[model samples]
Target: MLSTVRRLGVRGPAVVAIFLIGLFAIGCSGAALQGVGAPGATAAPGVATGDAARGPVEGDQNGSGNQPPAAPADPLIIKTGALSLQVTGLDAAVTAATQKVDGLGGYVSGSDRSGDGENASASITFRIPAARWDEALAALRGLADKVLTERSSTEDVTGQVVDLGARIKNLEATERALQAIMDRATEIKDVLSVQAELTKVRGQIEEMTAEKGHLVEQAAMSTLTVTFSLKPNPVRTEQQGFDPAAEAEQASASLVSVLQGVATAGIWFGIVWLPILLFFGIVAGVVLVVSRRFRRAGPGDDTPPVAPEAGSAA
Candidate 1:
C-alpha cells in the first residue's frame, strides 16, 4: 500500500505541472495575437502614440476620412548624405568641415586624405545630430569652391521598432510564466525544464532589447560623407628664343650615329658576307670555262678520221 501511495504522489505533481504549462502556452499565444491586432498595443518606452495611432473616423463632417493617416509623432528615420566638392586646399577644407560639424553638435567619424598638391583629395565621414543634418551640410558646402555632387536619403524603421517592442513584451510574459512554474515545481525534472526555458526567454529578451536600442540610436543620428578634391590648375604657356649651343649638340649626336651605322655595315660585309660571295663566284667561273672548252672542241676541232669499216679495210 505504501509503494502504491508513493507512485500516486509522484504522478500527481507531474499532472499538475503539465496542466500549468499548457495554460501558460495558451495565455502567451492569446497575448501575442492581441498585441498584433490592437493599435499601439506594445509601444516602446518614451514613444508617443496619441494621434499617430488613431485612424480617421467614418462619416466625419471634417472630411477626416478623406485625409491621409497621421505621421508618427516620434518617427524613426535614418538619414544619410553624400557631398562631393572641389576645394582650393585639402587640409584647409578638412579643417573647416571638422569645425562646422562640431559647431552643429556633430563629430567626425572617419577621415582619409590621399595624393598631394594639385592631385590631393580628402574623404570625411561625419555623424551629425538629426536636427542639424541640413545645417551641417550647408556649412560644409560653403567651404568648397564648387559643388561637384550632392545627394541625400532617408529610411523609416518605425515598424521594425514597434515589432521588436511587441516581441520583447511577449517574451517577458513567457519568462514570468516560466518563473512561476519553477517556483511551484516539486520534482527535480520539472524544475530543471522550467529553468532551461526561463534562460532561453531571458536571452531572447536581451537580444531584442539590444536591437531596439541600436535602431533608436541610428534614428537619432544622421551620417554625412563629404569628399573634397583640389581645384584644377590653369593651363600655362612659355615663349623663349632658340639656343645655338643646343642645336649644335643635337647635330653632332646625329652625325655620330650615322658614322656608327656605316661602320657596322662595312664590318658585316667584310667579315660575314664577303667570303660567301667570293666562294660562289669562283665556282661559277670554273663551270663557265669548262662549258666553253667543250663547245670549242665539238665545233671548231676536226673530227678524228672515221674509223674504217672492217670490211672496207680488207
Candidate 2:
C-alpha cells in the first residue's frame, strides 16, 4: 500500500482523492451490512407499510403507556331523561318520583324546590339504567298530575363504535411501529425521535379512548327529569242555611214567575194583545167620529130633544 501511494503521489493529488473515496465507500458498505445506514432502518415501518410488528404491538396499543394496558374494552355510555308535570303537593310528588326512579336502578343527578311560602313546586334530574328507560318513562307518566312536558333523545354510536374500533386498530398499529423503532434504535437521536412519536401516538390513543368511554357510558344508561306542581283538591261546599218558609216562598215565586213569563210571551206572540189592540183601535175611531159630530152640532145639538116631546103628544 505504501509503495502504491509512493508511485501515485510523490504527491499525486488524484491518487489522494481516489483513496479517500474508496475508504468512504467501504465504510458505507459496512454500515449498510450492519443495517445502520439503510434508510429502511429509520423510516417508520408503520408509515411505510403499517406492519403489525412495526405498528401496533401488544401493550402500548391504547396509548396509556409502556405498561401493557388493559385490552381495549367497550366505550363508555351516557343516559338522560327529562320530564315536566303539573301536580299537587309538589314535595310529596318529588319524593315519590325520586323513589320510583331509584327503585328502577336509577339515581337523582339534581333536585330543586322553591316558591313563595304560600305556593311551591319541585324539579329533579334522575339517571336510570338504559335497560329500564322505557319503564322509567312509563313510571313517570303514571305519577304525573298533569303531564306538562316530556322528552328524550338518543345517539346511536353503533357506527361510531365500529369506527372507533378501526381507529383503535390504527393507533395500535402506530404504537407498535413506534415500539419497534424504539427497540431497534441504536442511535440516541433515533431513540429520542421514536419516543417523541410514541408520546404523540399515546396522546391520540388516550383521547379516542376517553371519547369512546363516554359514548359507551351513554349507551349503557339513560337520564330522567321530573317536575311537579301543587294544587288544592276540588271541594264541594254544603249549604248551612235551610229555611222551609224560604223554600215555600221560592216555589211560589217560581210559579208566579213562570205564569208571568207565559203571559208575556203570549202577548208577544199576539195571543193576548190582539183583542186589546183591536179594542183600542175601535175606540179611537169612535171617539174620532163623535168628536167630529159634536164639533158640527155646536149649539144645535141640544135641540134634538124636541122630537121626543112631539112623539108623546101623538
Candidate 3:
C-alpha cells in the first residue's frame, strides 16, 4: 500500500507542474510559435540555408571565370599560285627557277618534263615559305620570256582553326570527366562502358589535333606551280656571193646531218627490238634452208620411202 501511494504522488505532481509551465510559456511566445511556418513568415534556419545554396551565382553561364582568348591579328590564310611561262630553253628556265627557290629558302617539291628542244615543256612545283610567296612568285615570273598564265589564290581558314580550338577544349573537358568516372567505376560493366566513351573522345581529339596541324602547315607554306615551255629560236639568214668553198661546206654539213639522223633511228630500233628481231631472223633462215633442201630432194625423199614393204627380204 505505501509503494502504490508513492507512485501516485510522483505521477500527479509531474503532470500538474508540466501543465502550469506549458500554459505560462504559451502566453509568452504564442505568436512566434504560430508564425514559424506561416506563408509570410521567415523560414527556419535549415530551409533558408538550403535555398541559399541552390540559387544561381552572378556570372556568365558558360562557367569559365575568364574571358575567351583574342582572335589572331592575321587570319590563317593558305596561298597558292599557278604560273605558265614561255622561255627560249626549258632546261635553263628550270635550273633558274630551282636556284631562285633555293635562294629564297624554298625547295622544289616536284618536276616533270615532256617533249624535247623546241617543243619541250617543264612543270615545276615549289614549296616556298609564306613570308616570301610574293617575292618568289615575282622572281619566277621574271625568269620567263613571256607570261602565258598567272593565277593566285588565298583561302582564309580562321573559322576552321577557331572551331577546332573550341572543339578540342570541349573534348578535353569531356575526357577529364570520363577519366573521373572511370576512376570511380567498380563493376566490370561500368569500367568497360566508361573506357569505350573515353576512347571515342580521345580519338576525336586526336583527329582534330591532326587537322589543326595540317592547317597550320598549309598556312605556313605556299604552293607555286610553274609551267615552262621552250620556244624555237629565230633563224638568221646571211647573204653572200655564191663561192665554191661555201657551197661545198653547206653540202657537207647537210650530208652529216642526214647521216646522224639515220644513225639515231637505227640505234633506237636496235635498243627496242634487237632480241626479238634476231630470234625471228634465225627461224626464217632455218626455214629457208630446209625448204630449199626439200625442193632439191627427189620425190622419194619427200615421201618417207614406203616403209620397206612389210618385211621384204633383205
Candidate 4:
C-alpha cells in the first residue's frame, strides 16, 4: 500500500479520502435499510412491546391494528299473533285472559265487549314480553272451550336496526363536523349555511332515532290480539213439541198487530178523509140543485111559448 501511494504521488491522498467518504456513506445507507427491514428496530420510543409485537385482530373496529375483539349483536325480531276463541262464557274467558297476561309480565292494551249473555263477545289486545309469548298464548288458549282461529307472525329487523345505527353514527359525525365548521365560521352567510345543513341532519337523526326506538320496543315486546265469543247453542236434532200457551201468545200478538193497523186506518179516515169527503159532497149537492133549477126555468119555457107564432096559426 505504501508503494502504491508513492507511485500515485499527489492524487493518492485525495483519492484515499474520497474512497473513505464513499465507504462511510455506503455503510450508513446499508445500516439504515437493515434497521427499517427488521421488525422491532424502528419502533418508536415508549411503545409497549406487546402492542408492537401484536398483529391486527379478526374483528378490530374499523380495521385499526391491534384493537380488541367486538362483542356480537343480538338479533331483533317483531312478533305478533291473533287468536279467536269460543268459550262457554265470554266474561269468564276475558277475565281469565287478563289474569294470564298479568301473570306473564304483560298487560291488556285494549279491551272491548259487546252484547250480553250467550250472545256476548269480547276483543282483547295484549302486550307480552317476547320471552313469554308462547306461554301466554298457551295459557290464553286454555281459557277457551274451543279455539276458532289462530294466527301468528314474526319479522326480523336486525338488518334494519343495524342500518339505522350506521346511518345515525354517520349523521352524528357529520353533525360534529358541521358544528365545528360553524364554530370557526366568521361570516353570517357561512354560519347560516352550516346551521341549515346541521339542522337538516339533526332532524333526520331524530326521526331515525325514534323509529329505531319503536323497532326496539316492538322487538322486546310482542303484540297479541284475542277475540272471545260465546259458544253457539247446539241445534236441536228433534222437532220441538207444540206448546198451546206459546202458540196462543203468538196468535194474540198477531191479533193485536192487526187491531192496531185497523185503528190507525180508522183514525186517518175520521180525522183526514172524512172532512175532505164531506166538503166535496156538499159542493156536489149545491151544483146539482143549481143545474135542476136552471133546466126547469129555461128561457123559452119561462116566456109561455111566445104565443105560438100568431101569423102561422091563421
Which is the leading candidate under TM-score? 1
User: What are the RMSD figures for all models against the true structure?
Assistant: 12.0, 19.7, 24.0, 20.5
Candidate 1 per-residue lDDT over residues 1-314, each given as its tens digit: 11222333535543443344334433443343334424434432212121123222223335222122222468899999999999997888899889888988889889888998798888999999999988887898899999999999999987767656666654554465456456666777666776777787787789878998998888898988999999998877666779999999999999999999999999999999999999999999999999998988784546777899999999
Q: How well is each residue in 1-314 modelled by candidate 2, as lDDT tens digits?
A: 22343432324543343334223322322121222222334322222232222232356455332111232354344556577787766667777878888899889888887784436777787878888888888888887667887777766565555445445545655465446446655666666665776787677678777877777776876767677776655686986798999999999999999999998898786966788889999999999999999998786544545456776888
lDDT of each: 0.69, 0.60, 0.67, 0.68
Residue 23 Cα positional deviation in candidate 3, in Å, after optimal superposition: 60
Give the local distance difference test score of model 1. 0.69
The C-alpha stretches of model 1 lying farther than 4 A from their native spots are: 1-72, 240-314
**Residue 200, candidate 3: C-alpha displacement in angstroms:** 0.8
Question: How well does candidate 1 match the true structure, expressed as C-alpha RMSD?
Answer: 12.0
Clashing residue pairs for model 4: none
Query: Model 4 over residues 94-189: C-alpha lDDT tens digits?
Result: 888898899999998898889987778889999999999989989988988899999999999866665565455445544553454566566666
* lDDT score at residue 304, model 4, on the 0-100 scale: 47
lDDT of 3 by residue, 83-119 (tens): 9999887778899999999999999889888987578
Q: What is the lDDT of residue 40 in candidate 1?
A: 35
Measured with C-alpha atoms, the lDDT of residue 159 in candidate 3 is 67
Please report, as a residue range, the 10-residue window in candidate 3 with the lowest summed lDDT. 28-37
